[model samples]
Target: MEGECIHIRRLTEGSMSYGNFYWEFIKTNTPVIVTGVSIKWECSNWLLKHGQENNIYSSEINFDYLKQQIGDRLVVVTKCSTHDESTVSVEMQFHEFLNYWRNQILSSKADVNNVTAPKILYLKDWHLKAQLPNYEFYKVPQYFASDWLNEYLEEHKLDDYRFVYMGPKNSWTPLHIDVFGSYSWSTNIYGRKKWILLPPGEQFKLLGPRGSLPCNIKEEMLIEKSVNFLIIYQHENETLFVPSGWYHQVLNVTDTISVNHNWFNGTNIKYIWCNITENLRKVMNEILEFRQYVNFKEDCQQILKCNFGLNISDFLEILCFIANSRLTLYMKRYRSKDMSGNRKSVNSHPDNFHIHYDLKSINMLSKFIAQDKIVFNCSTLYDRCMNLIDITQEIFLER
Candidate 1:
């Protein structure tokens, strides 16, 4: 099957209100390149140096400053090679990677396209926020503050979805979806990146006969197949919002530093629920012979976590936390309603809209999952979720 090309919209900071953004991009599940939003971020100022290249101003990350801050910290580095699927990774101190980065830069400068031995090392998924809690690098923009995954993780002091990625030119990640089918936003602190993004479901077409997807996509393949995708050149200080389930491949066009987070909110919670259920089905099928065991459901949940990083119980806890929090806001807002018999559209209050929208979305998923006895086997949690949903509807919907 032939596919058409896709164009991603670009928006300036303050160009559109959060309401319009939520509807146009979030609700519609579209990709967008948002500029000017990260210009004033602290990291943008302190960690980068202003320079002019080809008569255009640009920001480059300061290697010296980065080393001073966290050079001794441990980091994971992936070694990528040209046309290779067996990428090896190692854990080393940050300073070691920096030394490698410096050497690679010098080598590339000497021979831009013909370097015989180039080290394509990428440092990714560094939990910088967890390590330096007091350091205020960049604040989460209001438009993305409804991140349930990070909010729950932060509140429980477990872990965060936020990450810092640094890689030299020629480093790239293969085509894949984000964890739990969550929406992801990546902001470039410095340098440029080339992103190849395919809309949801298009990736399945690229799968091989045995259900294996290529680790690295070839330019010839995209040309022969006429695959529909957006080729975005993300410049410095720009943020890219990738909607849920979108398959993307990122290559560092220049040595780049970026912060990325994977999160899901009411806008994409259905995708998260779908991902969990699909994985649950696969787990059950893999262990079909043991289905009659008394601990069958528990065993499935355990294996689900081991394989997919989340299970039914973990999902239910997240749902309850989000549902109860939204219910509290709804009740608080209900108490503050105008006493003069005046009412307004839900859209008039962004917070109120979020409360109502998130609660309704959560309730829909919770209700559906509650009926699945094989996966959602916890009776106590089910009752609590249903009670919360009932209270949410009674308190918010009536108004």
Candidate 2:
């Protein structure tokens, strides 16, 4: 069941708009290279300030300055070989991680036992943007700014999905999909990475008979050797837009650092709902003993809430937020006028994509909320949605 076609398209910067990105890559669930998006980022200059120009990408990225800025904040790190949650995490100061990153590959000495030592420190999932919202290193592209996950999370003072990844050469992540089946963008702020990506369902075929994907893509015991995967050698100042549900494994080609964000908007949120429901059903079936309860379905949904950070109520609330936001934006777009009171045409706004996407999303969410067999019912949710619809007609349609 390995895929036979592998493609990762490349697009240029300075001319690409959100419309171009949406229609081409987002709609198609395809990965693309966006060059020069981070050209003006201060992080790019920081990447160069610490090393020779020819090797700037692999340079230290002014680690001393970053160390001072972040101070002694402890970061979570994993051993590359132990990729599962069962893997123990070691928390160390930020300076220690950087010091180890600089020396992980370079340290060499004559060993008394003549045996090579393995470096297992892998800095993974450091939520830098959430911690430092005012960090002025780089700006997110307009195409990715309408992020519901992190925006909602940030607004509610919850943990966000924005993260920074740093690791020495040979440190690699196991193949996995992004959280909640969301699309992700990773920008190489310093150094290079080798990405191996498999589209949505192809990753399942690479799993062993026990039904887990290989922990390491380069493992000798890989279940399927011929699985078709796109290989990308990502360079500095470049961004990789990974579409939703794609399973990707990354290898640091140098002592590298990058910015990563996981997001899902109204257009592609159906995938997220489907992924969550599917997982919920699987877990429910696996825990059959819990079926004895009077509220089995609610129990399952609660289990999903604990494990996945989203319950049915949480899902509904997110839908309500997005629907309300779209209602406001659409009404604003509808009512825009000049000083002469003449209505303005909406073609000037790139956000015209919202109507089609938003309608489809609202309809889907509406159908789900209207389901009689749902886990729980909230009259307030239905009332809020109805009021928004009423306001939409009153504000946008009524002349």
Candidate 3:
């Protein structure tokens, strides 16, 4: 049986209750479901029928066949899935097929026998434009521009921070937060999606051991964990609101079609900017390391100055802030009790200093000018350090 739709009343009531109980929680981050948003299923069916009448099947067609019929064009994956039991399991680009049909008729290749056939039937492209190594020759269609979705975007005031994601069945969007400084809402229009969410404090455990930046979880691990949570929905159009700072992984349970919008109002603008600044710092560090090893300092410096318009020192400060924040958050979550003990034992400098020998702490300090600079007087930084000590003390005291 199809899943029940998430009604407006339920959303309003639930958000109100949840918003109050978790007022601090919702202010920082939360997730909610909204239903009866649009008639996406009807639109999906309409596109499918149009493809059949035009003798066009996107999955069974190749780029060569399309080029022969319609020249070059952008083909967006509107639906996909690995579950053969699901109706939308087969991935297809309806608009691409439609474009091919129209071009074929204009080019007088309308005869069914004359149309070029592909050797491989299922020619699916799963990579998004940004994910592609080279985006010059490829283009992604904007499924978010559908009339129904556009209307919702207008009502919700999210027209600016919109993006389209297309993936094959069973593909995973790894655990990460969004960029562009906005809270996001993702809706499943054509198939099922399973999501596993982690609160901010819990994020350290999953990422720290892996030695990964918050934005860069290994895709394979994300896919495995998300599939384990596999939630199925055969009907009812629904959207999931993902508040700022919530780490989540999504698995397209079937060949799926979905649209996502990210929006920043007065509430989340500061936090969103903080997230972007953190990401930029990570990217800069990677570039700097590459330049040092490759002896391309001059070339890299030019790119940094010309492209990013930032000098090395300014960039280094940002990097320091991001690294300190990550370490602070990690230690706070994992070693808070030790922090308290160190505070109490400050008189015994040598003994308390031994805590600095912890590899993670040492490594973090090594990256900065000195321990003092590394632990600068930012409240978030200071709280994280104390929290780390507290966590460590609890563990050792137990032992």
Candidate 4:
């Protein structure tokens, strides 16, 4: 089913504190739209001049400025009209894509009877921050500051989840969940986007033969199948928080540019763990004939990594790092206690509750990991997981 009505809450930038946002929206797995949030970001210069109207700033992307900064850089663009999935992705210079964008814009304004539909090209997943280290365009808002996935990736010098997406009108992404079932936030720097979000577990209703999700969902398909979904219209300088396990499709209502990130932290780490374990079980079942082999478990882990982008070891490492980091903060707070038979208040740290929540979640995950036969067989990994749990427990005791 499709086009079912579900309300998406709207909030202003200053309406709620980070803690409130986490408990109300994040823990509840609700989507929200925040306005007036990205208006002052350095990236906004791409969208607006020095004026405002009806609380909505109006301007298109500054193509000349963008070209000056990254015109010659190579970028990946997807041809939405291509029938062959294998050849859909093509690499080209940014300026060349801009030329295509100009043509698409012109075609959008041309008489329908006289003009042919332009090739809908979408430039997505550009790692702009990694490509230009000194180009600081925007800061992560406080509500999304607990991003553990990108933190681990950046620490290990791996690729980041931060991305810039640009496309002309009607360019869209197919319905899909975020990688690793992490939460994501997308902020429009210019133009507008229409988002159709299917809530957790509702995507199963839209599955086709062989259990594949449809490439392009059609209104007629909603007659037989049934699903509850929300439609969100995101405007320039507005950010959308998409919770874990939500399947979503985004279409550019106008020519658009946006920044997005996929991340997970304590708030939804259990969901992340569950997703990994479920995928691992599927992988093992698919290759059941190889179970007798000595390296079957390891091979499965690698295959999971190949398909899902992370495996058991990677999960444990992330857990250990986050556990240690939170424990260190806890210890520093503990040491700051007064010697006059009274302890210093830990509430001085704005994120005290968040830090404790992270440690607790990590500890819980570690206990689960310790019980897994595959992880228990690896001595080094087993010790690391156990030690992390113990450290988190000690920190809780001290608190």
Candidate 5:
């Protein structure tokens, strides 16, 4: 029931190549803290230092100016938890949330072990990328840049998975998994956060009937030996990558602001596909009489599409999109006079490994998913995926 404790490590761009970045971290699905990221982002310095001297993260971000800039948009804020693992939230204009946020900062009782009055508030999942693209607050590091979810969403002209989070000390979100089993990365611009991360394959042991982790992560920490997890105290300007399927709880150790994105790429696509189909299958099996009706599986797929954002066919489309794009680029590269070299082990150049890895990985995934029972419901789309796979293999051999 227990797994190895997560390795606590840090890296800078100068420390390792992207090839090692993959084999050491991405391929192993481990969490790491990365630094020297070229995020020399002026937004962090500019916003953090509004006008007066700053506080957390040493930023001068002025309270009033920011309120004036983003106040009218509706924001979602949660009042401090009254029930275990269930915090109630309300939607109000951004300015209104900041007013309440200011009141919490003034009433903060951090010195007191427990302040029972005036519950704290947390503003979460603000779609900053869609609403404020010109901000250009940060750039994706090469280590985590192969993000297919955001890439696909952008291609379709939809809102991306990027989000901004802000909250005062004592605000927290309960333990939960990322949507669709996607990998996630979060970077703290200011203040620090305490993270409790549990590995995959162990969530069912902790999940309650409502499918959420219902116990206090702090309480669970008291018995950490019995329940293994990673305790990460993320600090200023540090980035944390959470691999697919990990369950995590985050608490603002100080007044804080951060940006995060959830993305599924070639590295974790199968995990994403499996999570969706398994959940859909569970819904169908739980309602047996419902299954006796005509086309029950397909009906369940429809419901899942509306709720979970994807089913088998849509998942295949993402794979094909990336595969074909990579194929096209590689063909161009192979035809060039520069690439007339012999094939070598994948442990070569950082960029070269990505090409070799992508070709083999995509071909394997396409073949495996094509044979899955869930693909039986949609013959035409599945056939197209196989054809795409064939094209991928053909182009790969031609190179």
Candidate 6:
């Protein structure tokens, strides 16, 4: 069977009014495909064949069985329902699965459990440790990492980023944005997938109780047209470049596999990191402030703005200043003399001013400041330090 043909168009000089058309898309928040570039087929085939041969039946797997199958280097996480009678299942990392199947034969233990229903699964970066299993199965990286993408990355000076993702079927990554401060182009090297994207300003409600780990919003709410941008495909060898700050959820439609590269060559890189750091602070504050509040989602959205700035890089230095100031305050509280040495003593204060920092975190903050990539005026940094110290002293004296 053949896939749908996508229109290809070369973006020549003065093709579309670059300023008007491009900026409009950013302003209106719409996704577009820049045609004319060729797609990669070899890498896609290699991935598909790898999955077909080594991917295990989701139903018949257990932690112990997988450990024996893949050996000790695997990181396995099992998601169980809150209800007692619910069935148990597991998801294994891609590298671990490959190590196990490469040396061993088909085992009888896999047949013991009736591996029936299919659940959401995710495998991250399976190819780093192993070469593409078979070239005939899917397109190779050489196809997509062509002159077009390479030239684009170079023109934008985005060569510093790394591409590290490997995974198999039944493993689905949670809905989230790309990491390491850049836009991402995710191409399906193996199977079909369903992608749901939430643009800036969309409110995605949380799935778990307030302050749960692996924070995720309900999938059902993501389907509403008013709240999400949805795309579904099968056996489609295409690349989708998602702009920075877009919230996305991906599901493997078959025993499929994929590879994605996140790059940070543009000004948007700094902004993306800023957005992530600010969001983390907001989440931590919400968890601390309203441990009792059930509607934490609404509260968080209220304070955040939809458009952080023109692009991620635009506000990189400023956001770094905010982040550094916050971290310094956290460190001062930990080193203060007034507080009892016990860590618990810091939390008993009525002002809710408790903060903590460790050596590794402090070192990282200092490095960012020293790089000058995140420049802060001397007065601003000094003011932040004094305020943090005063806040700590006040909290301790009140206690």
The best-first sequence of candidates by TM-score reads 1, 4, 5, 2, 6, 3
All candidates' TM-scores?
A: 0.92, 0.84, 0.40, 0.91, 0.86, 0.43
> Better model by TM-score, 1 or 5?
1
Q: Of the candidates numbered 1 and 4, which has the greater TM-score value? A: 1
What tens-digit string does per-residue lDDT give for candidate 2 at 63-109? 77777666678899987763443456799888888888656545633
Top lDDT hit: 4
lDDT per residue as tens, model 1, 112-171: 677486768899888899889887787776567679899888888887899989998888
Clashes of each: 0, 0, 25, 3, 8, 33
- Tens-place lDDT digits, model 5, residues 20-70: 777788878988988756358544652544344544224533568666555
Q: Point to the candidate with the largest TM-score.
A: 1
lDDT of 3 at 354: 30
lDDT of 6 at 164: 29
Query: All candidates' lDDT scores?
Result: 0.79, 0.70, 0.42, 0.81, 0.73, 0.40
TM-score of 6: 0.43
Please give the ranking of all candidate structures by lDDT, highest first, separated by commas: 4, 1, 5, 2, 3, 6
Instruction: Evaluate model 2: give its lDDT.
Output: 0.70
Can you tell me which runs of candidate 5 are displaced by over 4 Å?
1-7, 36-39, 46-57, 68-71, 109-116, 204-212, 219-225, 337-356
Mark the regions of model 2 whose C-alpha exceeds 4 Å error after superposition.
1-5, 50-58, 82-86, 108-115, 218-226, 336-347, 375-399
Reference-based lDDT, residue 141, model 3:
20
Over 4 Å off, model 3? 1-28, 40-72, 75-160, 166-168, 208-210, 213-235, 279-399
**Candidate 4 accuracy as lDDT:** 0.81
Candidate 5, residue 378: lDDT: 71
For residue 332, what is the lDDT in candidate 3?
61
